[model samples]
Target: MQQQEIKALLSDMSLEEKIGELFQLPSYFFNGDMVTGPAGELGITPDDLRVSGSCLSVVGAERIHEIQQKHIEKHPHHIPMLFMADIINGYRTIFPIPLAQGCTFDPGLAEKCASIAAREAAAAGLHVTFSPMADLVRDARWGRVMESTGEDTYLNGLMAAAMVRGYQGENNDFSKKGALAACLKHFAGYGAPDGGRDYNTVELSERTLAEDYLPAYKKAIDAGCALVMTSFNTLNRIPSTANRRLLREVLRGEMQFDGVVISDWCAVSELIPHGIAADEKEAAVLALNAGVDIDMASPVYLKNLKELAEQKRIDEKQIDESVLRILTLKNKLGLFENPYKDGSEADEKELLLCASHREAARDCAEKSFVLLKNEDSFLPLKKGKESVAFIGPFTDNQLLYGSWSFFGDEQDCVTVKAGVTQNYPDADVFFAQGCPTADPGTNVLGFQKTPPKEEFDLQEALDTAVELAKKADKVVLTLGEHRDYSGEGASRADITLPSCQLELFHKICEVNPNVCVVLFNGRPLDIREINQKAKAILEAWLPGTEGGNALAGILYGDASPSGRLSMSFPYCVGQVPVHYNHMSTGRPFAGDYRTTRYNSKYLDIPNEPLYPFGYGLTYTAFEYSDISLDSDILHKGDSICASVRVTNTGERPGTETVQMYLHDVSASVTRPVRELKGFCKVFLEPGESRVIAFPITEDMLRFYNITMDYVSEPGQFEVFIGSDSTTSRKAVFSLC
Candidate 1:
């Protein structure tokens, strides 16, 4: 269908039919049974289901085909229903979480993982995926940080654009097989909730919002993302779902996003609880007028939109515009020609968890594992000779896939015990459960099912682990928070390992001189105690399906860990929202002024993080020389290159992510000490030396000035190029 045809169809739709197209209901509403459960409680009637434009969280090709057949048979306009779900990281063949993928620092690899996820999801009859969350997160206490790419605007925008390309394909053609429309989510400042709580208020100035949070979403939209989902939080004092200034003036107007806009789960009706609307009718009017084209999982649009239009309280033209956008998306998906576009049961069977997909997952996990500590080069253990003891809750656990793996089966996951056995068949590998992943009676959200009952005695498990640690030559202590601990609605006040696990580790360390720690978690943890006690530590954050195999490869000399930290690991929970790119203060803390109490410094702890952003360790070491600039001045229409020589000084092959940072020494407003501008991941063999060059353009220096305009002023700037954010190899230049 073309533009004229879509417009003609919209003109023919009745007022009630157009209103129905704006409501998105769940899959159970179309089950053909009497509404008597959650749907009935929500006041969703049969008429609402009959004309709904889309369904949420629906799976299976056969079930989707059946639902589409039933819906088309009854829908007044015969518009096909769009099937959408939370296919964030993976569908069935799970991969590393978004944070871990960011550690890889390879946008190409992230794109591959998302492409595979899209293929698996498309085969299962999913038409849209609510993913590529472009939120910029700095607080580890926020559980949803696991879903973001990390703290840097450049890296977040880079990864988000790659994911958009991966999901929609290069041509943005959803009509092709294995391509699903992508929806960038949690619009505005969903990642910076107050106190790091979920759905809490977000307080940010327009400059900060534009300079930090909005760029990533704009990157995805510029890459042709088909839809944008309103966030649950309030930007400033207005809820994002009903903030016309945010949705209409900013997102659709300034961002130039002419795509369908959908509300987050039930966010339209949530305006009432948010103290912005009086009732359902007011909520519907507010959201539709604010530029929300679809109300997801909410009955306000179904129950009140028609009446609001009839009473002249809301414009009917808004209804027609929204219905047209929805129809345009359907036509873009080629659904008008074939409602069940390429959904096949055979394709699902052939694509899900295939060998190639497993290999890709393993490779990504290998690149994503960060070697945070490698004292005395204790890793790459003697596989066949050493008697190793694997002690802790995650030693043999199959729950390696983290939260939001909607369709992945834990039974199919490969455990660490199994991976080690496969890699070191002749070694004596002992195993013991140090303690449960968390204490009993832990509070889990109702949406996330309750954990299984702990059947073992805690003291006994600790004793068993200690004895095994004493007998074995080396101990591989595996530990982490439970999988449900870090996801949506799973925020925590303390971001550290459980007390029982800490006790178990202390006891084992007393008996064993050599210990290697493997962590499976979602967010950056407070690991001060673990850092002091362990000889080696590997941050394997929620590696999916082939997690064990990937860890084994790194431990047995098969691969080197090249992953870097996207978010900073704090010194303690009190240093909650720490990042590298913080604005410079008037009274800044300095080493020379440590004795002075008047400066901005913490009395008990350092202001810096335990591990700063872009910080990580690899098996091999790389040496960097001083940065050399091609020119000392940069003018408007030309660019200069900054070059640095990096050599693999250690006796092994490795990959190094050369990072380039810029500092605006004098600006209209306070600027960060250093900001990441460009990066390159280079692979090298031992004794190999390569010079990496980054082209510096004036456009890269632009930022929101004091007057709220994006521009760059002429000034002297400092540049640093090296391994991580703290590198001191610097060069000076001027923008004239």
Candidate 2:
């Protein structure tokens, strides 16, 4: 529909109808019965469903078709209801979680997975996906870190843009059958909650907010993301849902995001509990005025918007503005022309979990496994030459898909035991459940319910595993946090393996000299103990449906491990918010502990992480030469070429990600010790060498200054080019 047509439709809508378009309810509200149970308790009535602009978390093509058909028939304006869900990674053909995808360091691959997810989701009648979470996370204790593309702002922005493109298709053209509108969330520093707690206060300076958190969302918006979801946290003492400075002035104005803004699940009404609003009416008024176009799963908009407008307490124009944006999105999705857009039972059957998608998932899973430790080159195990003992809870477990995979069933997932059997049929493979992922009485903290108890005696399981370990030539000890341990509202105080699993690991290590640990988890864990004990460690972070096959491929030499860490793995839980790009302090730890104790250093542990960001290992070793610069000076509007010769020194094919980092020696504000500016991935055969070059431009050096100005100060900058953030290969250049 054209602007004139949408405007005319808006002009014809009754005040109640326009106001209703701003409320998004769950699917059950439109089931042709009075809203009952939990949904009914929200004060939502059958009449509210008839005029609601969209439905949340609705699935199945047939169900969506039925609900949409019924909705349009009763809606006074006949505006089609938008069906939205949290399709973060994949719909049915589950891929790696966003954090794992970040480890791939391949934006193009991320885009491909998102495209496949969009295809599967659109077939199931989903019109919008609340995904491509652009939050920059540093704390591993925050369970939702699993959903974010790790700590770097640049990488997160790049991946966010790629996913936005993948979901919306080229040029935001939703006319394509498989394309679905993408929504970037949770807006404005949702990842940096105080104490790493979910929905906690986020107090960031305006400079830090723009310099780190806001760029990723802006990148997604610039890539034509159709909507933005307000975060649940309070940014700088103001609830994000009602922060006019954040939503209106910064988001819509500075970011130039014209997309429809929706509140995070019930965040509009949550303003009351946040101490910003007196009641639901005030909450609705605050959110609506603050530029939230839709109130998701909240009663604030439905119950008070109309009354507030009638009483002149709130402007009716706010309702019109929001309703117009909602209608614009519907038109962009081509829903006006076809209410049940691309939703077909046959399509859902053919598209979801298809062979091609599984193949893609397997390939992506292969690339996402970060080989954190490969001591003595113990991995890529010789198949027929050794008897392998697979010991742990995840050895045959199918719960590989992490949290927020609402539609993915565990039965369809392949197990590690099954993968080995299928890939290496002749190998002598023994299996035992050494220990459960967690103890039966363990608290998962926040919304995740207690998982079913494992019916096994602890002593018996330990004895069985130890016996297998002693008999076998190699012990593949699989261990990790339970799937329920990470994701929204699931923060943890201890980011380490459970005590039971640790005990099992110790028992196995005592019996077997050659032990390989494969970790299945969501967030980066404190693996200091595992690092010291295991001969080899593979960080296979909750690989999805093809997880088993992917791990087997890496273990048996079918594939090479190339994934790098997007977030740093800390030495212990005490280092909760560690990252590579931390600001330089006056008394920085210089790593020469013998020199002085007065510097900014921990007395018990090193300030550095156990594994820094961009750290990974492959079957082959890559040697980097000294960094070379084309010139010693970089003037305005000119570029400086920084080059390094990388060679595959080891005896197998591998992929290496060469990272480029820069440090601003002096600035108006304290800068990070080293910031990742750019990186490139290269595949190399043994004895192959290539010289990679990166152009250093002034635009890449710009940052938000103390005066809130985004500019680059001319100074002498140091550049480091090598494997990871801790690389010491450096060259100096002056930016004039």
Give candidate 2 misplaced runs (Cα > 4 Å). Answer: 30-33, 443-446, 592-595
Cα lDDT of candidate 2 equals 0.92
Full-model lDDT for every candidate: 0.91, 0.92
lDDT of 2 by residue, 495-607 (tens): 88999999999999898879999999999999888999899999999899999999999999989999999999998878878999999988888876555699987778888
Which ranges in model 1 have alpha carbons more than 4 Å from their true place? Answer: 30-34, 592-594
Worst 10 residues of 1 by lDDT: 26-35
Candidate that scores best on lDDT: 2
Clashes (candidate 1): 0
lDDT of each residue in 1-736, candidate 1, tens digit only: 9899999999998887887889998766756553887678888777777888999998989999998999999998898999999998889988989999999999999999999999999999999999899999999999999999999999999999999999988689978999999999889899999999999999998889999999999999999999999999998899999999999999889999998999999999999999999999999989999999999988899889888889999999999889999999999999999999868999999999999999999999999988899899898787777889999999989889888887899987888999989877887889998899888667577567666666898988999999999999999999998889889998998988999889988999999979999999999999999999999999999999999999988988798899999999999988888899999999998753356688887877888898888988888899998888999999987899999999999999999999999999999999999999999999999999999999999998999998988999999999999888998889999999
lDDT of 1 at 114: 91
RMSD of each: 1.2, 1.2
